[model samples]
Target: MATLFDEPQKFPLAERLRPQTLAQYQGQAHLVGKNGVISKLLQSDKVPSMILWGPPGVGKTTLARLIGNHVKTPFFTLSAINSGVKEVRQVIEKAKTRAGSILFIDEIHRFNKAQQDALLGAVETGLITLIGATTENPSFEVISALQSRCQIYILQPLSPETLVEMLENAQKQDEWLKKLNIKLKETEALLNLSGGDARRLLNLFELVVSAFPANQDPLVITNEWVLSTAQQKTVRYDKTGEQHYDIVSAFIKSIRGSDPNAAVYWLARMIEGGEDPKFIARRLVISASEDIGNANPTALVIATNCFQAVTMVGYPEAEIILAQATTYLAASAKSNASYMSIKKAKELVRKKGDLPIPLHLRNAPTQLMREQGYGKGYQYAHDYPHNFSPQEYLPEAIAHTTLYDPGQNARENELRKRLKNLWQDKYGY
Candidate 1:
């Protein structure tokens, strides 16, 4: 008995179908399961400030909302991208009248230090229980002081079982979808496109369904049809979530592989997708050292400068700078020696506990320590030719264990020659 709409008007399928209670929610059983930590806390009605870290659409926001609803207190929500310090203060002020209130901030990592600091006093005083959701790792993106006040719970990607179950439930639960008699004959293509994200899966399912005519009752959804229909959508690439990381990985690998053409191509793809310039710039800085390394020392300097320039100039012009850095790094000599060296060095330290520093390498500032022969045999490199004393700098137990084997590049070749002359095969350089 519904009248036809003159214009398209409705919430997204994801929103319309969002679970209002924990019973209807799927996935993230680790947190919502019977023996789960969050479940126990909710059972006790003890709500603490928490951060839910996960990839896109795995129920961070949904979980936060459910917790707020379960708490039976004043619930407020804000998006860090648009909400600032003033907005945060306003929420806190409003929550003052309601004790044990819950405030959920979606993409909380987007809030800068000052804005995050604004929530500290309210949270510290127990005025508002904060449920923050972030796609980025909290250790890197969150301020330490704020992070110290909150417990971080990692949400895993939705399993294939959970995703399929959602699809099955949607057809039976949604009024419009139920009438469509949607039959998912094949879901591999649809799930693959979702990348284990629940919201994406629901929205994508909506898109695929909308592609068919209304009269197409008992509509059959096949992998081939889903693929063909989805490919026809306006958006070519996803700018967030797993696809974002994949695109970034491709961009970095292209530069490391020394394909300037491909590197620039990937860089253009990221720029066109409205990627954060600073994020792309950061990857360039990492690639400069991790991929280019000492093989082209200037690559690091140029990349660092590129990051600075991009942060200052931003967009339109920043793309040109990113392109310059990307191509230069791709064209430059490549080496992982520096990257491998630290990795091997850390492994050695873990294998070999705190070994005593060689007596000569130990500091002898005090007269009593000097009597123990701390600096007795230590040779000062300044007095030696080429500033190379050729003494064991490492602990005696692991002496001469080669960690840095220069790459097979022109610059590293020179390094290999110099190391060979200095150690004379001592380090096997």
Candidate 2:
């Protein structure tokens, strides 16, 4: 077993154990099971452009490779981090001659608008089939035009059973592990550390095994042993990995929960971890409107200015601005009234689609529309007392619908009073 660790030096345990076939793959049964969408797609042999959206180390890259192999297509790989529009153009230029080629981009969300736009012509036309993998949500990260052309598949985290199976298999199948005769007495530490990532699970297993004596036959593994061995090895926070989302989640939840102390602490955690100042600033803007709203209108203003200020002043100075905004928002009066109002309004619109607008509320743009009684009985709010026209602006079918309910805060209480006095009993105020 002298070359046990040395043999797999080039290819890590995760890469070596990557699922070669759909049957060999663990987890995401909904996507690749007997009746899965991917199975059906493969049966028909009609592979379209797709974006695989999931967390890190969940076989996104592996699945992309498997798809290329199964379809017998020329597959090209690119990293959005180092590759830009120029590299993208080079791939496209080459893909022109090879029709039905597959171009897989790892961390596809990192591509900016211009870089994504470069792929539009090729994707729109059938020159190349794009397979984009990203950890971020495609709706927020990908350009709508490009996203519209690709089917998005979500890969879920590996289950505990699947993860355990993977570790056990790696130990038995690997030539080096067999030689070491490692005894896996317990796996709680490895599973907990993996955080449902299959690649991380295998990596942790390998690391723990390598630390033991070279000639130690029956190298026993246990929760306590693994934790102690790997604790000194692994980094607690990864800015580009799963820990990035966890810390940000804690930060946002602290703000929403109105704990300034926790909010500021989480903010420090982010800044220390090298998180993007703009990202923190953007969340601050969203939190202001979403959590504080009209309960403290100035909160939104402060957050907006914080975003602008951070954009201008980065790093050490930007941390100060972020902390200020985060604390102020956490301490402010909280309300989701405005956010809920829009959500309810959109839901109604979707459920009762294209509900005809009352002619009075509709704009009289042409003579024909005017003759059709558009704006015939429209009452201008400015012409009435208190600048409030007590007419139903919503369509007659959904008249008297109350969308905006003011929050029970000092500022919104005044708004509630004004609305109640104006609408009277008609709006149930």
Candidate 3:
């Protein structure tokens, strides 16, 4: 009996329940709350160009749409995936005709420098209020000029309470979903699978409900049902996209945090999702130096070997190599001292504008150079006791500065003692 005009039940649960206004929006209370910056902006007439940076399904696009609706502006949406520079120009040309228009670009981080540049004039001239949505870090992906013009607002993942509330709201608001006699017996599986993505959570919930037999009286949502249904509908992880970066980040952080179990879990996720083995290996190698450092120098060797092994062996077998490296890095005593010291040293060089190298430390390759006092007083450390000379090595301007602060780990502790003994109070070891 369904007519063309009749409400279609085929629409996705998430789409059907999409918030029409800011008032109905479920999460991001920090942004939409009474005194929040976004709320304040909405209260006013002016809608500034902004980039909403957050995880997937945190409602960046929804917020942009709500802002357009609230301001009653001509709204145009373009996806960075399919849209190019040509499309960007077309949109801007159309916006020029309208007095006040809002251009929303989803996955804006995917836009190339040239495509993003296309938006600069429109956003800068106030021809179109640009609202960009990105799941990736904008600093890395967005060009400086375009990024400078737009305000960045960070949206956090939906909390468990907020997610549950969203689910309840869907049941209450959606006529089709409301018709079912449903009870949520468990939510941990749903929450775990969603990974704080609101849209994915709703879609998974719908899939579970649809699995129930029509003759079944009460629809029971359990962890088992959710897991089974989810397995059948495999989780969509785009290895070349946002999820790739997210999983790699988690993997690196797990090792950095010294959680072998978590490190291995994320590594497995990447491997199973068919992520490039070399890419994962490269990150592992970086983590070995940056996070593990001098706490276990062997970690770098192991990570390097793992990378080579994976490159030679390839996947199926490569997963084992990656897992081995991941666990070793996680188990090793961690330190960022070496990494931080290099960063500080680099910063000093940049600030000091290449301070002159000390005369004593300079190499006197020829007689004329030696006559100019080059390497004149450079103490031979091998001739000194303990093969150590407490001499000035850094540029004269920063000679007294201590860049390498040894961490408190056992190995670095010994290093600290040695440096302290050699330098007395010179380097403040």
lDDT of 3 at 213: 70
RMSD of each: 3.8, 3.7, 8.3
TM-score each candidate.
0.84, 0.83, 0.70
Question: 1-429 in candidate 3: lDDT tens per residue?
Answer: 322123336788888888898889877888888888899988888678999999888899889999999999899999998999999889888887885699999989779889998888888889999999987778867899988998999999889999998888888988887887889889999988887888889987887787777656688899998998789545566664436766888889999999999999988888777787877888888999999899899999999999899979997899889888999999899999999999998998889897888999888899999999998988999998889877888887677899999998999999999889888899888
Question: If ranked by lDDT, best first, what sequence of candidates would result?
Answer: 1, 2, 3
How far out, in Å, is residue 317 in model 3?
16
lDDT of 1: 0.88
Writing each residue's lDDT as its tens digit, candidate 2 over 12-52 gives 88877787887787777787788889878988888899999
Clashing pairs in 2: none
In angstroms, what RMSD does candidate 3 have relative to the true structure?
8.3
**Model 1: per-residue lDDT, tens digit, 323-367?**
999999999999999999999999999999899999998899999
What range of 10 consecutive residues in model 3 has the weakest lDDT sum?
Answer: 1-10
Q: Rank the candidates by TM-score, best first.
A: 1, 2, 3
TM-score between candidate 1 and the true structure: 0.84
